[model samples]
Target: EVVRQYKLGLARHVNEHTGRPLSRATQTYFLVALRSLLRYWAMQGLDVLAPDRVELGKAPSRSLKFLDGDQLRRLLDAPDINDLRGLRDRALMETFFSTGLRLSELARLDRDHINLRTREFGVIGKGRKPRIVFLSDAATNWLGRYLQARQDRWKPLFVRMKGKPDLAPGGPGMRMSTRSIERLVGKYVRLAGLGVKATPHTLRHSFATDLLSNGADLRAVQEMLGHANLNTTQIYTHVTNPQLRAAHRKFHSGNRE
Candidate 1:
């Protein structure tokens, strides 16, 4: 029912008239959920069942979007660290910049996940693949300050209040949800006056961009980013072109001629 209403709302929002999440993907999710509910009821012989008329919706692969360095810097510098929220926001932003973590991986980070001495942190990402990320002194020191201001024994490193991590949607003790972390990123984006569409993932793109611009190998960046495919890292390669163009313009004989 919720999915049905959501589809209707989405259609109405996208068009002048109301529509349903009549997409095959939407149907699959709704039908699968209904089947689960029906099975639970049938185990007790309640005879409940989902109607069989439902079908799946179609979906296709999509490209990702990311932010550039100047815009990124403005965004990072946007957070107000004098207050609690600002401190927390800066810490999260720093973590994203330094680690290139998926929002889920970052949200799941606990006290045990961070190690200041090694300048590293551990993240269990997609497929539960564990990867180690080295944090810069800038990131580590900022994190330390954020943790110091934080007043919680909760497992997640970033929390909302006394007992809850802002991204931890499950509750006080559980790590925050990926959705919650995304929302937090959105709020800070506006505050930073970036004037560009961005989210937490933009930090990941910036991480790769900065690395490529610094002359790090593309393969090395792929490993750091935990991408299964080399093509994913190729997008950041474009960022390096602007720098190359600048260098050529200033030093090349072609410009002199």
Candidate 2:
């Protein structure tokens, strides 16, 4: 009874809540928690809800959100090159789009993690697995510039400000936080006036979409994105639907309309 009521309540909240509907991703988390509880009860010899009987609601197929080439150029250009902060922001944005790194992976980057000559680096992704991410020529150039302009001996790849009054005694100038990266991305996104709610994750989406659109193999994309499951990488396949439509219109002999 408790399980039934909990399931129904979750469905109602997801379907007709006052605030924003809880995303399917969020719902899956809730379901997993419930399943764990039920499994515990079953292990204790209780005749409570069966964990195996619990099913997660299907997540809707949502299209990927990404900026086009022009929009990307505009965003990269939004940060002023003359200023140190702008230089850092531009490099950060370029790296996000080029490497498709998760926020945490990017946040934890240390100065020694990247080799400018090689332009390739390894990141510890989810599940504590290490994977390689390469920087594009453009990304490399911007990052090189940012590194050259840095006067501080900060240990982090990206940091707040040098000699700032509010900077933590030994904290602020260390590693850049994930939230700070998001704010930097947001600031440039607004300045570029793309007019879409884009986050750092959107840049990651753009990286995958660009690769798939340009005929990169699915398996290669999966490896590059460091997706543990192939299904996670398959999301980019949906974003390529427009290219599929174009090909169909151009080559299909039966469809002359």
Candidate 3:
């Protein structure tokens, strides 16, 4: 009866800031946490409810958000290349689109990690799994230009250009934080007038969607995106399904009649 009441309360919960009902995912997360706590208590011989009694409600499928080609072009051109900071921003955006790297993985990059000649590098993604990420020619050229303009020999591939470097032992030394990269991407998203909220992860989605839309094999994209399971990569298929339908209608022999 207590668990039933708790479930009802969660279902009726509202978001304080948004003034909307709590999302299904959020509700499920709360239930999962509670279940874990109950499990621990039960293991300690406490008279708590059984963990298996806390059933999680199914959450709706997540909507994948990505920039279209025109939006991507506008964002890529948003930064003024003449300025050093602008150059860095352009390179950073290009790399995001080129490599589909998670924000933290990109933030941890060092100057020596990339090979401009090869246009490829390896990154440790979620689960501490390593995968190879490739760069586009455009990304490579922009990165080369950005590196050439920098005077300091900072070890980090991307750095906070606005601040002075800390040369102290174990200091970050102008290394760009993940938060800074998030803000940087947000700034360009506004400048480009995308009229949609986008983050660094949005570019990663764009990268995956763009490839799938262009007829790249799904399994290959799964590898590039470093997804632990192919099911995670399958989410982008819905976004490309319309294009596939259109192509079938146009080219399929059955449509000739």
Candidate 4:
């Protein structure tokens, strides 16, 4: 009864950050932590409710924030390609959308890690798992242009055009940090006037959604995104289901609507 009451209290608990009722996921997190503590106490011979007695509420479906085709095109075009920095920015954005790589994964890349001819490379993603990432022709073209324009030996795939003293021709200091990449994405997001909050991860979402919408397999997407579990990749299915329904409506012989 105490556990039931506590669950009810959590349901009504207000979040200090959002000024709203605690989300089901957050409630689950709290409950899980409490359950672990209870289990620890029980192991120590203390009289406490069994952890199994604490039932978790169902979490709401995830809402994905991704750019649509038009928005993506606009965002990609946001950078001034004629300029060196702009060219680098364009390449970075293109690579993000093409590879569906995490910000850290992209930032950790080196020039030697990529193969322009094959347009594919291996990356160590979450959990230290290695997966292959492929580059689109556009990404390849932009990257080639950016690298060619550099005209210097830089080991890092992407580097700051200007800032900080020049250490060596191939030094880690020249590499762009993940935070810098985030700010770069934000700058273009504003310039594109997307009217939607987006980050580098948004491009990853867009990449997954774009593939699924165009009939790519879910498992394939999971591998491409280097997800540890298929369930993590399944979140994108919610975004693609509507497109599937539309396709069914158009092609199904028994369609009445």
Candidate 5:
């Protein structure tokens, strides 16, 4: 009875306090926190509930959010190229889509981390595991143009312009934060009129889905994504309903001549 009450209370807390409708992801996080707390108490020899015995809420499988080819084109073209900020924005968004990097990973990159000649770079992903990510030709080109336009010798690959164009390169004010990258993504998403919620992570999702949809091997994508588990990468395998219908119509026995 106590365990059941605890579960209900947690669910209520999520719905009533967290937000309306309670996101499945947030519910899972709440459950995880509860389990961790239980484990800690159990270790201290408390007569509390067993952590492993607690049931986790099942999250309904939802379609992954990603920009289709047209949307991607529109977003990539949304940034203006006529000015310094525009050039940097173009390169930043291009690099994001090309590399599938998490926002923190992308924002923390230093100029030295990139090898412009090879157009490939290494990033330390989750768990401090290092992996190589390659840039598309378009991404490379924009990055080159952005770098050429920059007069600052800033070591950071991307920097924030603090109101003054004359700020010295490599100064403390030049670094871009993760929040800034999120806002930038939001800005372009609105500008492109995509009518979908696209954070910087959406570009990452698009990158993975694009690879998977084009017949890239699952395991190979797992490696490229730096996922610790193949199951985590499997989520990208879900295709749009239209693609499912097309496949069914093309290959089903009933459709055969």
Candidate 6:
């Protein structure tokens, strides 16, 4: 009953999101989550109706939020590297741009996951699949700066702010949560003063977009992103420069001649 109540509650929640019904993507995700919760509870012998039976309204036709070229440049330069916190943030941003590591994959990384010498990183992506992401020269540079000032003497590549960096300090192993990663990216987005809506996942979108714009193959992008399905990678093709030009040439009044 509580699950059903929440399902009904989503209408009002969706209203707050866009003053309209939930977009198809959002509704599908909501239904999936509700169904999963119902399944878990039912397996425990609890009585509950499955959310899959609920009719999803419709999904809004909208493009994913992404950084434009100029905005991306500004975002990459947003951090103040003189301080420890800034260095860590810059490294996170750079690594995300260089290799579209999902938030969880990044959070799970320890020092061992990264090979500083070879400029490559190991990430266990979706479905526990492992893939290697190369570190760009810029990533290597910031990482070195961050590591040089490091005092944790621990494996976690990034650390939250604590009192002073003690070269040999007494502390437990700390790793940032997925939410923290989101907020950290948000901080830089604001600092960059791009005035664009963005989050950590923005970097991933930027990675895929940049690759498509540069003419990378769909299969190659799929592999780098650790996607099991090639069709999933096809979305980038839809947003490529060639497609954009074709669309304009076909529909624009100025180019229609």
Give the number of the best model, judged by TM-score.
Answer: 4
> Residues 142-173, candidate 2, lDDT per residue (tens digit)?
89999999876667888876455334543545
Which of candidates 2 and 5 reaches a greater lDDT?
5
List model 6 lDDT by residue over 1-257, tens digit each.
66557667765564543367743443444554455556667789998776456554443434344566778778878888888888998888878877767887777777656777866655666666555566666777787888888875676777668555435433334667788889888888888887767877767766655554443443454456676433442223112234323332232121111
Ranking by TM-score: 4, 3, 5, 2, 6, 1
What's the lDDT for residue 62 in model 1?
48
Scored by lDDT, model 5 comes in at: 0.69
Q: Which is superior by lDDT, 1 or 2?
A: 2
In the order shown, the candidates' Cα RMSDs to the true structure are: 19.5, 15.3, 15.6, 14.6, 15.0, 15.8
Look at candidate 6 and tell me the lDDT of residue 12: 54
Which runs of model 4 end up more than 4 angstroms from their true locations?
A: 1-64, 230-257
Question: How well does candidate 1 match the true structure in TM-score terms?
Answer: 0.59
Model 5's TM-score against the true structure? 0.64
Per-residue alpha-carbon lDDT of candidate 4 for residues 1-257, written as tens digits (9 for 90 to 100): 88888889988888665578965544654565566667778989999988878776543445325677889889999999898899999999999988889999999999998888866677887767676666776788899999888876878998887777466768878899999999999999999998778889888877766665443545555567776643442323113234333432332211221
Best by lDDT: 4
Give the runs in model 1 whose Cα sits over 4 Å from its true position. Answer: 1-64, 162-174, 230-257
Worst 10 residues of 2 by lDDT: 248-257
- TM-scores across all candidates? 0.59, 0.63, 0.65, 0.65, 0.64, 0.61
Candidate 6, backbone clash total: 2
Kindly report the root-mean-square deviation of model 5 from the true structure over all alpha carbons: 15.0
As a TM-score, model 3 comes out at: 0.65
Flag the better candidate by TM-score, 4 or 6: 4
State residue 87's C-alpha deviation in candidate 3, in Å.
0.6
Candidate 1 local Cα displacement, residue 177, angstroms: 2.5
lDDT of 1 by residue, 1-257 (tens): 66477455544443123343343432333344454445556677796544342232333434224555666667777888898777877888888887678787788778767877666655556655554565765677778888788666666777664353335543446555677678878887888776666778767866655554443444554556665433332323112234323432332211232
